[model samples]
Target chain A: MDFDAIISNLPLYLKGLWVTLQLVIMALAAGFVLAVPVALAAASRNLLVAIIPKAFIYFFRGTPLLVQMFMIYHGFAQFDALRESFLWLVFREAYWCALIAFSLNTAAYTAEILRGAIEQTSFGEVEAAKACGMSKPTIYRRIVLPSSFRRALPAYGNEVIFMLHGSALAGVITIVDLFGAAKIVNSRHFVPFESFITAGVFYLCVTFFLVWLFKRLEHHWNAYLRPRETIAVPTIAATAAD
Target chain B: MRKLVTAVVTAVTVALVSTSVIAGEWKKIRIGVEGAYPPFSSITADGKLVGFDIDIANALCAELGAECELVPQDWDGIIPALLAKKYDAIIASMSITEERKKKVAFTNKYYNTPAKFVRRKGSGIEISMEGLKGKTVGVQRATTHDNFITGEFGEAVDIKRYATQDEAYLDAVAGRLDLLLADSVAMDDGFLKTDQGKDFEFVGPGYSEVKYFGEGAGIAVRKEDQDLVDMLNKAIDAIRANGTYEKINSNYFEFDVYGG
Candidate 1:
C-alpha cells in the first residue's frame, strides 16, 4: 500500500535481485554439472559406485535446507579445527556458505530427478543402440543422456524455481538477497506488508519467467515426441514416382 | 417520597459498584515477555520460563493481588502483539525509547543499564569510527543498540542484525562479527560469562545516552490503558520500595541495575 516506500527502496530491491539471480543461477549451473555424474553413478548397478552418491543424496535431501545452511554457516563455525583449516576460507564468508548449501541441496534434488529419468529410459532404445554396435560410452553420450535430459526437463524446471525460493534462506545467513532486502526495508520502515509483497511480486515475476523458459525448452527438446503432421501430395507427385 | 429517595440512592450505589468492578479491577494480568534474552528472560530446557524479568513480573502482580500470566513472545513482534491485545503489558527489557512511545505507553523504568561493545579480548579494536572501519558489528535486530550502531557507526562497520541476542552471540562466538553491541548487563550475564564467550571482553565504554538507549527497560502497555499503566507504575514503585526489586536484581546481577 505504501507506494512511496516501495519506489524509494527500488534500488535496494534491484541490488537484492542481482544477488538472488547470482545465487540461483550459480547454484543451478553448479548443481546441474554435479548432478550428471551423481545421477549416472546412482543409476549404475555397481553397489560400490552407487552407494556413495546414494548416501550423499539421501543426507542432503533428507534434511531441511535451512538446517543445511545453518549447519554450514553456524554449525561448522563451532569447531575450532574447522576455523583453523584451509576450508575456513570458504566457510567463513556467509555468501559462500549459502552458495555451497544451495548448490549441494539442489544437486541432490536434481540428481534424483535425472536418476529417475535415466532408469525410465525405454528398454528398446538401449537395445536398438546396442544392436547398432554402439559402445556403452557412445550410447550414453549419444542417446541415453540426451533423452534423459529431455525427460527430466520439466522436473528440473521445478527444481530451478524451488532453488530460487530456497535461496531466500541465504538472507537469514546475512547475504543481502531479495528477501533480505525486503527484511531490511521492513525493519527500517516497519512496513511488513508493503515490503514482503514487493519481494513476493519480484519472486512471482521470476517464477513466471522460469515457467516460460522451461516451456520453450520442453517444446524444443520433445519435438520428436509430438504427433507427426499430415501432408497432402498432389496427383503430379504420383505421376513423377511412376 | 423518602422511600423513593432511598430506592434511587441504592440503585445508584449498585450501578457505581458494578462499573468500578468492571473497569478498575485488573484481576488477571497477561504480561508479555521475550523468552530469548537470557539472564533477563529465557525458557529453560524443560520449557519453564525463568529469569529476572519473570520474577519481577510475578512480584509486581503479587503486590497488586492479581493473578499474572506470562506470555512468551518473540522480541520482534512484542509491541504489535501488545497492541493486538495478545497481552496486557510487556515485561521484556524494552528500552523506553521515543519511537515506542507513539504507540505504547511505558511504566517508570524498573531497571536501567547502558549499552556497550564487546570484542575478542586481544583484538585491540578501538571504538572509534576509524578503528572500527570495515569491522562487522552484530546486534539484535530492531533494538535500540541496533539503532545506535546503525546511526552512529553503520558507515564505518558492517552491521549484521540477528532476530535474537543469542544469535548475535552465536555469530560473535563463531568469529563472524568483530564487534557486538548490546545491553552491558545482558551481554555480561548472557554471553560474556559463558564458556563460548571466554575470549570476548567488553571493548568500549558503556553507552547510556538518553537519546539512544532511552531511560532503560520499562513495562509497556497500550496507550489506551493509561489506568493499567498507572497501576503497573505504582506496583513497580511498591516492589522497589518493598525490597522485592532488589531481590530479583541481585539474583541476576552483581551491581545495582536501576541506574541513577
Candidate 2:
C-alpha cells in the first residue's frame, strides 16, 4: 500500500543489509575456524579431552541466543572489574559483544555437526591410511578432516542460513542491521507493514542467495559421492575401436 | 422486623446497582500500559504492575464504574495495538504528538513533563552540536524524546534507540552510552534516584518544544472512540476536582506533574 515509503527508505534498508552481511559473514568465518578444533576435541576417544569441549558446545547450543547476547552485551557491562580492565575496550562496544555472542553460538552448533561427521568417518578410510603407514596427525589432516568437512557441507549450509536469521538480533543491541533499519523506518513513519515487509523481502532474498550458494558448494564438495560419468569415456573408446 | 429490614436493604442496593449500571454505560474497558517506564508504570519485583499511571487508570475505572483490564504493551507497538483493537485505550505515557493525532484520539493530558539529557557527573559535556558530535546518545525507541533527538540532533549525535527506557538506563549505567535523553521525571525517578545512576546527572536544560514533545502525556484511544474520549476527559476533571489526582501525583513525584 505504501510503495512510496518503501522506495524512499531503500537506502536505509541497504545500509542495514550491509551491517547484517558484515555480522553474519564475520560470525560464520570465526565460528567455522573455532569449530574445527572444538569438533576434534569433542570427538576424541578420551573423556578428559572431550568433556570440556562437550560442555562448551552444549552450554552455547542449549541456551537462547538472545540471552547469550544480552549476557555478553548487558550482563558483562555490569561488572566494574571488566569495565576497568583492558578487555573493556572490546566489551564496551555493542558490535563486538554481538559478534562474540553470534560466533560462540554458531561455533557450538557447527562443532556438533562436525563432531557427528567426524565420528561417522568411514573406518575403512582411516584403516587404509594406517596401512599406508600414515601417522595419526597426518591421517587426520589428509584423510579424516577433509572427508568430514565434505560430509558436513549440507548441514553446515543450513547452519549458515540459521546464523543469518539470528544476526537479526544484532539490532537489539543497537546495531543497525536489516531488521533494525526496518524498526527505525517503522517508528519514523509509523508504517509497520510497509517497513517490515520490505525488511522481510530483503531477508528472503539473502536466504535464497545463501541456499543457491550452498547448493553449489555442496555439489562441488560432495562430487565424490555422485555416480561416476563413464558414458563419455566409453563412447570415445568405442569410436577408437571402430 | 429484621427480615423486613434485610428485604428493604436488598431492594435499595439492587435499585442503586441497576441505576448506576444504566447511567455509566461502558461496562468493560481494556487499557494498555507500558510496564517499562518506572515511576510512571512498571512491574514490581513480584510481577505486580504498579506506578502513577496504574493508579490513575484504576481511579478512572472506579470513577466510570467500569470493570477495567490493564494490558501491558511495549511502547513501539502500543499505538498499532490500539488501532488493531488489542486494547480499548492506551494510558501509557504517550505524548500527545500531532503525528499520533492523525491515527488516534487523545484525552486531555493526565500528566506533563519536559525531556532532558543525562550524562556522567563531571563529564563536562556541552549540550551543543559541536560538543555532542559523534557522541552516542541513547533514547527509548518511538518516543517523543527519540523524535526530538533524531530531528534536532540527528546529524550531530549517534542516536541509539532502545525498546524501553530501562534498556537506555542500562546502557547509560554500563557506560555504553555517552548520554541519555528521556522524560525528565522518568530519568529522575527511574534512573537518577536509583543506585546505578549515582554517577549520572542531568546535563542540558529541559526541552518541551511544542513541535516534538506535544501537549504532555494523554490517554490514547482509537479515532472512533470519541464517546469514550469524552467520558475519560470528564472523569479526569472529576478526579482533579475531587483531590484524587493530587493523591496519585504525590505518590510518584514531590511536585506537580500536571504541567501548566
Candidate 3:
C-alpha cells in the first residue's frame, strides 16, 4: 500500500536487477562454454573421457549450489597452501567465488540438457552427413550441435530463469542482487510486502522478457514446425503480438 | 453445489478458530530464539539452547507464571517468523531500533552491549574511515552493524557482509577480511576468547552510538501484544531488583552487562 516506499526504492531495485542480470548472463555464457565439452564427453564412446565428466555432473547436480559456494568461498581457506598461493587472490573474493560456483553448478545442468537434446537427433541426419564424407567432428560441428541447441531452447530458457532466481542467493555472500536489495529495504523500512512485492515485479518482468525472447527464437529456428506461409520471412511483429 | 458446501464448511471452521483465539487469554507462550549467536543464545554441540538470552527468557516466563516453549529460528527469518505466528515472542538478541519498532514492540533491555571491531593481533587496522580505506571489513548482513558500516564507512571500506557472525569470524581467521565488526560481548566471549579466534583481539574502540547501534538488544513481540510487552518489562524489573539477574550475569560476564 505504501506507493511512496516503492517509488523511492526503485533505484535500489534496478541496481539489484542489474546485478542479477549480470550474474545470470555471465553464468549462462560460462556454463554454456564449459557444457559443450562436458556434453560431448558424456556422449562419448570412450569410458575414461566419459566417467570424469559424469562424476563432475553428478557432484555438482547432486549437491546444493549454496553448499558448493560455501565450500569454495569459505572452505578453501582451511588449507595453508591455498591461503599462501596466488589462487588465494581469486578465492578470497566472495564475488569471484560466487561466479565460480554458479558457473560450475550451471554447467552440470546445461550439459545434461544438451545431452538430452543431442540424443533426440535422428540417426538419418547423422547418416546423411556421413554419406557426404563428413568426419565425426564435422558432423557434430555442422549438424548435431546446432540442431540440438535449437531443440534444447525451451528447457534452456527455463534454466536461464532458474539461474536468475539462483542469483538471488548471491546476496547471501554480500553481492547485492535483486533479492538483496529487497532485504535491505525491508530491513530499513520493516515493510516486507512493499519491498518484496516490488522485487517480485522486477523478477516477473525479467522472466516475461526471457520467455518472449525464446519464443521468437524457437519460431525462427524450428521453421519446419511452423506453417509454410510463415517459413520464408518470420516477422518480429507477429511473434511479438503472439 | 458440492464446492459451495465444502467452502461453507471451511469458512465456518476458520471463523470458529479465529473467535476462540481472540477471546482466549494468554497461557503458554512460544518464544523464538536464534540459536546461533553465542553467549546470548546458541545451540551447544549436544543441541541445547543455552545462553544469557535463554536464561532471561526462562526467568521472565517464571515471573509471568507461564510455561515457556523455546523455538530455534534462523536470525534472518526471526522477524517474519514472529509475524507468521511461529512464536509469540522473540528472545533473540535483536537490537531495539526505531525501524524495528514499527513492526514489533519491545520490553526494557535485559542487557546492553556496544559494537566493536576484531582483528589480528598485529594487523594494526584503523577503525576510522581514513584508516579503513580500501580495507575489507566483514559483518553479519541485515544487522545494525551492517547498516552502520555501510551507512558510515561504506565509501571508505570494502564491506563484506555474511549471513552469521560466525561466518564473519571464519573469514577473519582465514585472512580474507582485514577486520570483523560485531557485538562486543559476542566477539569477546563467543569468538575472541575461543581457539578459533585466538589469533585475533578486540581492536579499535567500542561503538555504542544510538544512531547506528540503536538501543540495547531487547525481547520483541507483535505490536498487538502490548500486554505481553508490559508483562515482560515488569518481569525484567523484578529479576534485576532481586539477585536472579546478577546471578545470570555472573554466569556470562564478570561485570554487570546491563551497564546500569
Candidate 4:
C-alpha cells in the first residue's frame, strides 16, 4: 500500500533483477548448447548413445531441481576428498553450483523438446533431399536441423520462460536473485506483500518482454506460411460465392 | 447412453464425497517448521526430524492431549502455509515480529539467542563493519540474522542469503563465504560439534536489535486461535517456572539462552 516504500526498494530490486537476468541468460545459453548434443543422441539410431542421454534426462527430470541443487551444492561436499580436490574451487561458490544445477535441469527438458520437434519434421522433405543426391550430413545440415529448430522454437520459448522462473531458486542456495532480494527486504521491513509484489511485477515485466520477443521470432519463422494477399482474397471471395 | 453417464457421475460424486469426509476427520495436529535451524529444529541423518523444537512440540501436544505431526516447510512459505491451513501451527523457532503479528498470533517467547558472526579460524577477521567490507557473509534467508547483517554491513558487505542455516554453514566451511552470521546458540551447535566447524570461531560480542530481530522464538498460531495461544502461553509459563524449561534448555544449549 505504501507506494513510496516500494519505490525506495527499487534499487535493491533492480540489483536482484540484474542477477536474475544474468542467471537466466547464462543458464539458457549453456543449457541449449548442452541440449543440442543430448537431443541428437536421444534421436540417434544407436541404442548405447541414445540410452546414456536418455538416462541423464530421466534422472534430472525425475528428481526436483531443489534436491538436485542440494545434492550438487551440499551432498557433493560431504566427501572429504572432494573438498580437498581441485574441483572444490568450482563447487565452493553458490553461484556456480546454482548455475550448474539450473543448466543441467534445463538441458534435460530442452533436449526432450528438441527431440520431439526434430522427430516431427516431415519425412517427405528428407526423401526429397535424398532424391536430389544430397549426402546424409548435407541433408541433415541444410534441411533437418533448420526445420527442427523452427518447430522447436515455440517450445524453446516456453523453456526460456521456465528458466526465468527457475532462476528464483538461486536464492535457495545463497545467490541473491530477485526473490532473494525481496526476501531480505521482507525480513527487514516485515512487509511481505510489498516486497513480494514488487518482485513479482519485475518478473512479470521480464516474462512479458520475453513472450513478445518469442512471438516476433515465431512470426518471422512462419512468414512463409502467410498466404499471398491476392490469392487469399480471391479464395475467400470464391468460398463466399460458393 | 444417458443412463450410463448418470451412473458414472453418481459413482464419481459418491467417491469424491467419501474422500472429503475421510480428509475432514482429524487424526493429528500438523506442526510446520523450517527444519533448517539447528538445535532448535533440523533434519537428522536418518531423515527423521529432531531437535529442541521437536521435543517441545511433542511435549506441548502431550500436555494439550492432542496427537502431533511434523511438517517440513520452507522458511518463506511457513507463515503462508499456516494461514492456508496446511498446518495447524508453526513451531519453527519463528520470532514474533510486530509485522508478522498483524497476520498471525504468537505465544510468549520460548527461547532467545544473540546474533553473532563466525569467520574461519586464522582468517584474522574481526566483527567490525569495516573488516566485512567487500567480504561475502552468509546468513539464513528470511531471518533476523539476515536482516541485521544487511543493516549493519549494508553495501559494504556482500551478503549471501540461504534458505537454511545448514546451507550457510556449509558454504562457510567450504570457504565460499568469508563469515557466517546467525543466532549464537545455532552457531554454537553447528560449528562447535562438526569436524570442519572446529576451524571456525565466533568473533566479538554478540548483540540483538529488537526492531528488526523481533522478540524471540515462539509458537505461531492463527490469529483466530486466541484460545490455543492462551493455552500455549500458560503451558510455556508453567514450564519456565518449573525446572522443565531449564531441563530442555540444558539438553541442547549451554547457559540460559532465553529472553530477548
Tell me each candidate's RMSD, in Å, in order.
6.4, 6.5, 6.1, 7.4
Number of the top candidate by TM-score?
2
Q: How good is model 2 by TM-score?
A: 0.90
Q: Rank by TM-score, descending? A: 2, 1, 3, 4
Candidate 4 on A1-242: residue-level lDDT in tens? 55665687789889989999988898888999999889989998899889999999999889998899889888887777988999998998778889999999999999999888778889999999999999988998899888998888889899899899988988767677898888867655546688899899999999999999999998999667667556434677788988
User: Per-residue lDDT of A1-242 in model 1, one digit per residue for the tens?
Assistant: 56777889999899999999999999999998999999999999999999999999999999999999999998999899999998988987899999999999999999999999999999999999999999999999998999999999989999999999999998887777899888877765556778899999999999999999999998899989889877875688788998
Model 4 quality (TM-score):
0.75
lDDT of each: 0.91, 0.92, 0.87, 0.83
Cα lDDT tens digits for candidate 3, A114-175: 98888888899999999999998999999999999999988998888898888888887777
- What is candidate 4's local distance difference test score? 0.83
Candidate 2 lDDT at A234 equals: 58
Question: Per-residue lDDT for B182 in model 1?
Answer: 94
For model 4, state the Cα shift of residue A58 in Å: 4.9
Error of 4 at B71 (Å): 6.9
Model 3 RMSD vs true structure = 6.1
| Model 2, residue B42: C-alpha shift (Å) | 1.2
**DockQ of all models, two decimals each:** 0.27, 0.46, 0.41, 0.29
- Ten contiguous residues minimizing lDDT sum, candidate 2 chain B: B19-28
Alpha-carbon runs more than 4 Å astray in model 4? A1-8, A37-64, A80-82, A115-137, A182-204, A231-242, B1-35, B42-74, B78-111, B209-238
User: Each model: TM-score of chain B?
Assistant: 0.91, 0.90, 0.90, 0.86
Q: Candidate 2 regions off by >4 Å?
A: A1-3, A229-242, B1-24
- Residue A117 of model 1 has an lDDT of 98
Model 1 residue A134 CA deviation (Å) reads: 3.2
For model 1 the local lDDT of residue A26 reads 97
The alpha-carbon deviation from the true structure for residue B212 of candidate 3, after best TM-score superposition, in angstroms, is 2.4
The most accurate candidate by lDDT is 2
